[model samples]
Target: MTKSLEGRVALITGASRGLGREIAQRLAQDGASVALLDRKAHWAEDLVAEIESTGGKAVALGSDVSDRKALTAAFESAVSALGRLDIVVNNAMWTKYAAIEDIDEESLDRMLGVGVAGIIWGTQAAAAAMRQQGGGSIVNIASVSARLGLPQAMVYCGIKAAVEGMTRSAAIELAPAGIRVNAVAPSTVATEGVRAMLDEATFEARVASTPLGRLGATSDIAEAVLFFADPMRSGFVTGQSLLVDGGISVALR
Candidate 1:
């Protein structure tokens, strides 16, 4: 809350709810002007108001992250409203739980479009805008599914794994422009969407398996993102994927 990100402008996709919402608030608290981009134009209005109420700057725009043209326009709109772009958070994703054999073509395409293609499009848009202004930071929200093999999550796992791959490759490719690309892979967190997806027994089982005896909090993931976003902390770091899985990953290993 020291305004480390003062004067910086950040754009986050899927900014309506869950991790995206929390990350937006976190950045705003650090003095970064945030642009909330969600599929529905009005979805982030309340969030924009929330930030404004606290003396933070925010704008809400509607665009599907999977569409390059629309996404590019959204980036332009954010810059138009906020003056400049400094941080880009590619947190938009569409997911479906299915067994390997049950994964349908339509579902696979949707997942790939939002989860994988969205990253590429976001990186492209951010790189274009950041290149003009010298440099910026890109934080992709991956998942523990990328590192662990979870049942009934074949499509999700594959897409998240691609996120890690894209993060590294983009980091190397964009370094010369002074842009930094990194990934944050979170374990199961207590989000509305997650709670809705899981049943009581499964939720308790996850807690029992986790070494920390509790699920991750939105703040835990946001703090990790702050570490990467604050150039003072991670200016020299890029292409790294920080796993915020509450030590469950290690316990399983």
Candidate 2:
């Protein structure tokens, strides 16, 4: 309501639903016009419509974040429509739970393509636009899996770890250009995607392991993202991975 982000423009990937959607909504509520990007064009359209219905300005773009050309076009279109790009949230990811031995080449390729390469390409494209605007913030969505390795999430863990590394390195490179890069790592968020994969027993076990004795919600992660995107709040922060995992990372092994 205070409109801290008034006149700012934001682009969010995988914003059709889940954490990405929550992040987009929160940013829009803070008065930033948003571009919702997703592989599912219809989902993007619906999200944009919802936001606009609520008196928020938004545009929907369909593009694969991992595809350089497509992502470039989407980023350019968003900036062209919104007038400038102030924030970019790289939240798209292809994740699956499988044992290391069960993971085949195809699965691995898809995971890395969306998880790792998507972040790399999105960050670079957003940074270029931000540079032109004199500066901006890039928020990469990572996972607690990177810190607390799960048995069936080996590839996902590896991809998130790579994202953290990239965030740090890109922050350093982009600092001189006035662009800030950071990441948010959440654990076992109760999104539809996670709920579908985890049973109540497993979910409870996870919560018990967390120091907070609870699982994370989409809003929990979105709040951290909002903080990082706010120049006034996190202007001095960059190249850092903020964990929004209900203290799961601190649980004793």
Candidate 3:
């Protein structure tokens, strides 16, 4: 069978580590040329080198996704090097867990800016390039927090909910242009970011709540992203948010 994404060019934000890195690696393994973008450019550089060592084509670039100018430049650089753009994975986010009283203005703003505004910038930039190329796909990484509403994660939930809303609206508007926008909402993925915030006991407790009795892995989320990015696999799908949670969202107290 032919690889679904052969000759496709994918630009994945937050490709330095965690779910983003896994997603980039998976797409490259499937024969897509990848542009790995992250604020930690050096991290992406190392990852890109690893991908290249494995016989995949990739490049690393640094850009603050919330900065429209920087994002635009990054997109141009990727196109210049890769020849064209076909997919965008908006996986960058700034997350801080805190109670309402403990949350400060700066932290809240940063979360919204990086998590929400970043998606907007990436989508707009990718949409423009894709429209020019005749079509494309966008996959936004959201969270089950947006639906289940965890304690001390109010700001993070807000940002994710906003992302879901944007995905729907963009899908509706961009459908006519052959651009598909959708989101994946994962629950408690075992990423470096998540590990930093969750202790062994806390992680176990959370996992136990899920019917699957396990936390999600980066590959779990990556597979969901791959499904959305392949037009042939999901050609009829748009304006949807696929929840990658292990039945946690449906759990009853």
Q: Number of the top candidate by lDDT? A: 1
Worst 10 residues of 3 by lDDT: 39-48
lDDT of 1 at 177: 99
Please give, for residues 167-186, the per-residue lDDT of candidate 2 as tens digits: 99999999999999999999
Per-model CA lDDT versus the true structure: 0.93, 0.91, 0.92
lDDT of 3 by residue, 21-65 (tens): 999999998889999999867878888889899888999999999
- Clash count (model 2, backbone only): 0
> Relative to the unseen true structure, what is the C-alpha lDDT of residue 86 in candidate 3, on a scale of 0 to 100?
94
Q: Report how far off residue 102 is in candidate 2 (Å).
A: 0.8
Please give the lDDT score for candidate 2.
0.91
**lDDT tens string, model 1, 1-253?**
4689999999999999999999999999999999999999799999999999999999999998889899999999999999999999999988889888898999898889999989999999999999998999999999888989999998899889999999999999999999999999999999999899999999998888888889999999989898888898899999999999888888953
